[model samples]
Target chain A: MLLKDTISAALEGLKRSRMRSMLTTLGIVIGVGSVVLMVSIGASFERFIVDQVESFSGDTFEIHAKGVQDIGKDVLSITFGDLEAIRGLTTVKNIAPAIFLTDRAKYGREEIAPMILGTTKEIFYNWSMKIDEGRLLSDEDDKGAKSVVVLGSQAAEDLFQNENPLGKRITIGARKFTVVGILETMGSPLTAELDSMVYVPFLVAKAIKGRTTYIDYIALQSINGDNELTRQDIVSLLRQRHNIDNPEDDIDKDDFYARSMEQAMEIIETVTMSITLFLGLIASISLLVGGVGIMNIMLVSVTERTKEIGLRKAVGARRRDILIQFLLEAIVLTLIGGIVGVIGAISFGYLISLIASKFLGDLTYALSVQAIILPLVTAVAIGLIFGIYPARKAAALQPIEAMGYE
Target chain B: MPENDAPLIETKNLQKSYFNEELETPVLFNIDLTIKKNEFVAIMGPSGSGKSTLMHILGFLDHHTGGEYLFQGQLAHEMDEDTLSRIRATRVSFVFQAFNLLPRASVEQNVMLPLIYHPTIPESERAERVAKAIETVGLTHRKNNLSNQLSGGEKQRTAIARALVTEPDIIFADEPTGNLDSVSGIQVMSALQELNEAGHTIILVTHEKSTAEHAERIIELFDGRITKDTTEFKTRKAKEEDSLQK
Candidate 1:
């Protein structure tokens, strides 16, 4: 028989039992929908993380002392000497040692607790923070050991509440400090941690802690953004300064580790991709069940149409022709399901991106072409794999026997 | 005359049997028959007389266990499945007692079915051929009606149009009027007789004496064997009978 006629005939058969055909394709619809949904959400999540990571300066590296409290803090601390030695490197653009403390602040009768980040004036150039109200900490403040501070936008709002915080005095633990600047609002995943912090000169914060405070972390900016070379120089200088005698290859023996912003982005991308593929694998089980449903209905169809099959054979349809007709029917059914699923997932993804962008920064959620094509191909393969047995049974029927079947 | 040519169909020592778990029950025994082109022949017998079995073997719908069956001077009984299917598609067609029209399809679509399987028929000519076949059976008015919605006589005429659409060398009708009322039966028989008169070779299987008398020749079977063969000089005209009944 001509392929055109076979296709029309298969369509006619399906149209005869419209409700059953729809119900039979439901499993495939759900399976393909979930797979495409996973891909869309995964791509959107990766883009969100990339946006958050790029919001900060990518040329900077953070070196944190590992196991400082487990080992003695003094033995594992990243100290002032290590920070000054790194600052002397030719590739270093800027460097600062930071100390972090959380304490309550008081201005007249109003009181608020804020995270206190203590670092030098050069720390502004290493991070991408901008001033909203007043000037940042000056080098004179560090040299004079002045009790001066900069307030994050949210901290300023909580402490002063519509009142100008610049030039205002606030008490931090046992010291009084003058607020010199207020940072702009940072809309990010780390907004709670960064946007509520008050910045003070590093030396003053150390004095507040009675001079036992070791540098909590060192932030370094690489000149020309060459993080690889700058990171190698910093790691070797710190290892040598701490007197670790292990070979250069013994990374586990190092007391401090440095991570660049670019490396963190790559790690996030890899983790999100793994989650997408694992969810896709789980979605395929529903596709398997869908295939079984197709086979079962096709079997019922073949039995119910025994007389029709006999008539077709009598009109000169060969075994292969009958096989092709039934297989084409199965494939057409799955292709419809695949198309519906792809459209549903794409619309759903767009809806989610629209709603989620209100809270997170602009998220670019685009479904890749591979995500669409692969699921459609899988749907076709499932049809073929599950369609064979019923097609063969229809093909092997003897005309006389089949016609006489009640 | 055309009588010098080979007969369109022939059988010698034809035999058939049904086997179930090593038990063989013979249905036809030592049957010999010959039919020429443009012959309207009826095989007549009561149920269980094996007349239907003989028609099935002749139509290539079933295989005879023992036979020398020739179609157009070729060994038809020994033909493979592909060859038989090719013959079925182009050289022969059948109309069953059930009408066998696709219930969900229109009469036009039902008649177009055999042409769908015809290997050499150009797609451009299919609709024209289907129209011509439906016109021949006098069913052009109801061509767009679904077969299930038609009366018994209309359905049988649609089946006849399906069989004729292929323009096969031979047409087989198996108890074509068995399910119809007398008026509808005469209408169907008249259609078959008119096709026969138009120089088409037709083989009909029927137990009704009146239905068999519409054919030019009759072969009677008794207990799986041919008991009599006769050529009637004046065959009953189904159109005249249909008018008389009306």
Candidate 2:
């Protein structure tokens, strides 16, 4: 028989019970919809995270004491002496020590507790922190331990409330500090921590807090973007300064850890991809259930149309004709559901992107090529997998018995 | 070679049995029959007499366990499934007692079904043949109505049109008027008589002696055996006046 005739016959049979056919295809629609939804959302989220990770400065590295008992209180693993020693290395282009203290800043009854970062003037250049209004801290500010502060843009906004806080005096724990500058907004994951903090000269903060032994971490920029060599030199120098002998390249035994930002970007990519795969796997279970549903409905259809099958056979239809007819019916069912599901998922993805862009800047939820091809291929394969048994049963029926069946 | 005088259907020592595991219950026993072209024959029997089984075998809808069956001088019993289906598509057709039309299809589509599977029929000629077949059965006025929407006689007439669309050499009809009223049954019997007069061979099966009188020859079956075969009788003419008298 011609393929056109077989397709029309299959469609005619399905049209006989339109409501049953549509209800049978609903399971496939739900299955493909969720699968597409998960895939599109997962892809968009990964892209969003990767874009955030790429925004940070790639030429910088950070070093901190590993497994310290007390993070900021009297730990001798990293000290001011170690910082001087690291600055002595020729590969060290620029470096600054950072100490964090949480304190309330009062400006005429507008009191807010913001994290205060204590570092040198070189930190502004080493970390590539831009200035929005006034000047950053200078060499004189650090060397003379002047009582000066630079407010982050978010911190300035909160403290002054649309007023110019550039040269204004704010009290930090009863000591008056002059705000010399406002740093530009850094939009990244790091923004949550760095954008809301106040900056001060390293020596002034040390003098006020009476910190003599340890700092939290050391931030440095590598010369010529050669972070690997700088990272190795820093690790060795720290091991030697802390007086650890022959640690045999076991980082677990080292007193301090040094890592470049490039390595952190790779770790983030791997973790996000894994999360996407895990979510996609969970969504595919519904597709399996949908396949089983197709099988069940197809079996019922075969039983209900036994007399019809016999009539067609008696009218000169071959066995394979019957098989092809029933199989095409199943494929048509799944193909319709797949198309509806793809449209639904794309609309839902666009809706999610619109909602997400409000909190995250310009997150475009795009449907990847895999999102389109995978669900459709899976739907077709499900039809074939679940369609063959019932079709074979229908084809193998004896015409004499079937025609006379009560 | 085309034999001008050969019988259209010939069956010798035809036997049929139903097997359940290791047990066999015989249904037809050593039946010998020969039917020529353009003959209207009726096989009459009560229930369990295997008349339906004989018609199924002769129509190629079934197989005989032990028989040598031939159609137009070719061994039909030894033919493969594809060959049997090919012959069925081109040279043979059937009408069931239930008037087994596709319930959801229009009368025109129901008549056009057999031509869809004909291997040699050109696509352009299908509509003409379907219209001609429906005209033959006098169903041209109800061509577009769904089969389920038609009366019982109309449905039977549609089945006859479907059988005629292929211009088959022979048509087997089992209990054609079993489901119709007397008036409708007369209409259907008259339609079959018209087809037989137009040189189409028809094999009809019915248990009613009155219905069997409409055929030119009658073969009576008793307990899986042919009890009598007689052709020397006056064929009854089915008329609408008889139905009106009742």
Candidate 3:
């Protein structure tokens, strides 16, 4: 039989049973749609983490005391001397030692719990802090200041409430510090709350809190052309200076728990990507089920058209001809469903990104070639696998018996 | 006629049997028959006399149990399934009592079915042949009607057209007029007679005496055996000879 005529016949057969065809294809649509949607969401989450990582310069690293005491033991402490030792290293550009304490700040009758940081003048530059009002503390302020502070935007709003915060004294944990600046709002970090914080000079905080030797953490900047060597040099020097036992062992094991922003972001991306693919495969089960559904329908179709098969055979249609015709019909049905599902997935992804951008201010979903090609190739492969049995069944039918079937 | 000339069909000891292991029933015993080119022959038998079984074997729709069956002097059993299909498609045609036109197909498409199976013919020529076949069967006016929409006589005529479209060496009719009224039956028989007179070989299986009388030769079957094979002179030839004598 002519190819055109066979295709027309198959199409006419489908047209005669419109409802059944639609119901059969519905399985494929749902299966493909679920896979695409899951993959797109996973990709979007990866992009979100990457953007957050790039917000910080890729070159900076953090330093902390190794093996901080377990719950039953006393906290392992690092000293201000260790920070100075790291800063004095040959490859070091600058270092910012930080002390973090949570305290309740009071303005008349209102009080709020805010994270307060005590650091040197270089904290502003190293941490990307912008002063929106008044001036940041200078080196001289750190040396001679009686009491001075900088409040984050959220802290200022909570404490001063419509009043000028600069020059206003807020009492924190039995100390009064005059606010010199209100820092602009920076977005939240993966680990820290950025909005609710205060900054004060390191010496003043140490004096007021009666803790002069210990600092919580340090951020290190390596000079150009020596970044990786500097990172290694600082880590080794800190390990030696702090008397860290088995320093090489700790470094090999990643048990020190220190990370650059870029590394943290990379870890987040890898984990999210793994989850995405895992969910995608889970959703692909339905796609396989859809393929089975197609096979089932094709088998039923072969049975239903047995007489037609016999007639064609009687009229000299070869087994190969019958096989090709049925296979083509199966492929056509699945490809059509695959295309519909892909369009639906892309459209849904776009709509979700729009809504997320509007509400959360961080929407960047995109469709990848894998998202499109995987489902299409999967559908075609499914067509071939599922089409074989029905095509063979049609080809194998004996002409006389088939013609005699009611 | 020279014996060397190709007969449309020939059979030697063509035996077909059905074995029920439990009942041991045999449907067809040893039988022998031959049909010449351009000769119209009718086989008459009661139900279960194995006439239909013989038709099936001759039509190449079934295999013989134990005998040599030949078409145009080629061994039938030696051909593969594809070759047998080709022969059924291009060399021999069938007209069924049920008017076994595909109910889904239009009259024109039904007539074109045999040609669709003809691999050597191009599509355009097939269409031309279909049109000519339909015109010959006088169904040109109703070519677009579905087979179910056609009358009993018209359905049988469409089957004849389908058989005629391939220009086969022989046409086999299994009770072609069995389902028609007397008027429709006469119409169908005359069509077969006309086709035979035009040098197309036809083999018919019928139980009706009047239907078998239309053929020049009648072969009677009983218990899977050819009990009688007789030829009668054409009535028109007898009348013409009488007029010449007067």
Candidate 4:
């Protein structure tokens, strides 16, 4: 009975001062909204990283020289013979050796300098590169060193705006080659940069370089099993083939190094996780400040309503009744703020997602269920935390003194 | 009626005091008093004479230190605050001097508040009782108005209706007309007189002679002790009864 009376009375009390109540509610709304938005943005960033990693299949590995700083820093590299040997191994399913070189690319009047990559057709499947129009290079093309090339998604756009580059001949580094295909847009800043490169047969690129036998990198995939063992077997076999006596000292002496796609995935997860934690810590402070505001106003309210407290007690309201009224009033106030904050957060997340997609190309603002719920829970807990002092003060007023108060 | 009906309220050598760290100040000295059921008793005193304190103790709104108070033949001085609260809830109600009606509450809400605490009365019956109380106070027309919006007389009437809504045994009004104009004061006193005529016990505390004159019996206090007790105003209720007998 007291709960019903007090709660209704509390609502009435708020209604009596609509402007003040609204102002108080605004504090919590901003606090909770920022927190939810921060959390959702964090989730979206994590999703963005995961999507980036997923584009390069999880079963693939990249082989390159250890501690190579630039294009020409490391002399130790992979040869075509070594690539054939790694393919012959039991654990190896597919291999593609590619050498990266930067040269002036030109088709008709358009000209720009971008990386020129030469590899077999296996790289198209290994890197999940989708061809826009025509077929990729065939095995016979790689063996015969055919002067046919595939354009990167960006390179095709820059070199051939509206015109079809497929079957059209273009000059790539003093050699004339027919464009066979163009890779679809990847949209990642890093992967998109890689997409700007032109792809050709391995022999064609080597012949252009005049007796270039060794390549800078080899990408490979393992048979359907644990890839860690496959990675280890590949490393030990390379050491044996290279005639390295001490394999443990390979970090300093060894010519080559290999990493699976899983290691890169782990790095992305850890970095994003820490970023979320740091941002979340900063956002929680606003909630604390909002709670403090509630506490401050409630204390003032208790003091101001001393006579009312006395009057209610004189007419038969118990301490618990007064306490429940003020406490529930505080809870109701924050709950209103919480609901408004959730809507504000979602709208903000959508707006932010739109803005981000403009520049980053399809980066989402993830508004997960957990992200929405945390701010609401924080709001209630804050109400409960900050509401106790004032309610208790109101409840403990003596009827005689309060009644006599002017 | 027999003359020997037990007193509805009996206080023997009732005393109240306030204490600081080093000294104790007594407010109400030794006093013995009895009020019967359906009595219209007014207590008058100068400032600091403890008339309001006595009324507060009698109305169960305050505690009287070092006293033996018998309320309806039950020893009440030793009762806990909760028990006192229960008595205040059902049997005793107060009307404060400042017209202490909740300013934010409408006249109807103010009147219904006391009944909200009455456990045995269902919620549905409270509205009817509140309406009746407002009618008795002649403020039924102002029931929807907030107390802050009402005139001084209307506010006091709403306070009285709040006192009356629970159907309490005793209505202890502490200077109900103190904050009102002479015209509003008279209207408020007559409302009390009307309630008294309906057989409800009315205990009033005031310093105004005209207000005290409305009661059947008046008691004057000097320095926390009763100096005079009189029945000078019996003619008003008695003459009305005599005319009714005609």
Instruction: List lDDT for all candidates, in order.
Output: 0.84, 0.85, 0.79, 0.83
Looking at candidate 1, what is the lDDT of residue A25? 81
lDDT of 4 by residue, B1-246 (tens): 123456889999999998899689999998799999899999998889899989988887778888788887777866776777778788888888887887778999889887766766888898899889999888878889988899888888899989888887799999898899999998888888777888789999999887898898998998999988897777367868888999
**Whole-model alpha-carbon lDDT for candidate 2:** 0.85
Model 3 chain B weakest lDDT span, ten residues long = B232-241
Select the stronger candidate by TM-score from 2 and 3.
2
- For candidate 4, lDDT tens digit of each residue in A192-266? 876788899988877876666677888878887567888888877777778777647454566787767776777
Error of 1 at A37 (Å): 1.5
Clashes by residue pair, model 4? none
Winning candidate number (TM-score): 1
How close is every model to the real structure, measured as TM-score?
0.90, 0.89, 0.84, 0.89
Angstrom error of the Cα, residue B128, model 4: value is: 1.5
What part of the reference interface contacts, as a 0 to 1 fraction, does candidate 1 reproduce? 0.65
Clashing pairs in 3: none
Q: List the residue pairs that clash in candidate 1.
A: none
Clashing pairs in 2: none
Model 4 CA lDDT for position A50: 80
lDDT of 2 by residue, B137-226 (tens): 899999999998999999999999999899888889899999999998998888888888788898999999888888989999988999
Docking quality category of candidate 2 according to DockQ thresholds: medium
Which residue window of length 10 is worst by lDDT in model 4 chain B? B1-10
What is model 2's native contact fraction? 0.69
For candidate 3, lDDT tens digit of each residue in A1-406?
A: 7787677666656665677777877778878888998899889867877776666666566776555434212244567777778767877665777776667888788798887777777777666778999988778778885578888888888898899988888898888888899988775453235567888887776676564576666776667745567667876776677666664545654334445656667778889999999989998999999999989999998898888787777666777777888887777777877888888988898888888777655759867899889998898788889989998999888776677778
